[model samples]
Target: MEAEDGKLKCNCPSGTFGEDCSLGVCEIENPCLNGGTCVPASNIADTPSCICPPGTFQPVCEQCYYNFTRDAYIQLDSQVMLAINSLNQTQCDEECDKDERCTFNFIGLDGCYIFEKPVIFASGNGDLNKYKERCMQMEECLLLTHILEDNKCFLFNVTLNNALSILRLIEGQHGNNIAEKICC
Candidate 1:
């Protein structure tokens, strides 16, 4: 839900309750349709209000603002694709979308940047102050596809790769073996 003053607007369906619209409604998770907050179902108040953004209506954040993460940082050390020239949050997402090694990473100097992946350790204050980060627009495009494993090159649903696969796993010392499973 679009949490403003923590006052949620439960947009529960016809016969439902709670901040999230899940209780009476078994349709979806959280039940807070359209990014609404599921209010706690009470004898007094029944129905979840979907706290949508200003321009959005109920049921979902349909016309509302796009969702993004904030205060994110890569853990431990940075496997940084270094020397990005002045990047903005949009560019950060764009970069993450393009990179294969980047599970998720973001610049720490801006308002908020977000990338989604597993968790890693955050950098220390001393390390954080060492370098400068910028978000200026630049002209660059990087497409990387390499053999990460013996016979496996990850190439499905890459953020910017247009759902295409690149490279074929050739023979290896361990005798190249290719088994296709759900993208792990």
Candidate 2:
């Protein structure tokens, strides 16, 4: 724009607003979604960003990392279970490598339990409700798989590499059921 004094005037840039363009741009063209909060950029040269709500992520908060149901049992593939004793960590790892179905293992004080579950093991115990309660108290616990016959509960922390596996576990079918944590 041309000012009355013949000087050039211009509008605020992409991520700036207000009279002097000092305010960060957010409300004008908010990029956030799924209830995410828009955080304007510090400088006019930079673009605004979004702060995703719980259970959601990505630049626009369009993706979700948590399941919608809490403590809900999910069916998984027919997994082969093995119970062994006195196996060290290296031996347990070797055992898991031997079988394509063996995805993870739980090493207890007394023995090791191997299964084809997808999520990584954080901790496990014979008491189902006890570990389930402990998983609730933990901030990183995203999924829990329980073996009904053995009365074992295993806690898992979800990550990008394992999120798809966890989702597949939800869609699988078998006798055993896994519990997924719901963030939203």
* Runs with alpha carbons beyond 4 Å of true place in candidate 2: 1-21, 24-86, 93-104, 108-117, 122-126, 133-143, 155-178
| Residue range 1-184, candidate 2, lDDT tens digits | 4474776565766666665666665766777888889886666557778888765654666643333333334433334346789998888888888878776776777677676644445344456566656666566667776655555555667633364554444433343445566543
The per-prediction CA RMSD against the true structure, in angstroms, equals 17.6, 7.9
Best by TM-score: 2
Residue 19 CA displacement from its true place in model 1, Å: 42
User: Against the true structure, candidate 1 has what lDDT?
Assistant: 0.34
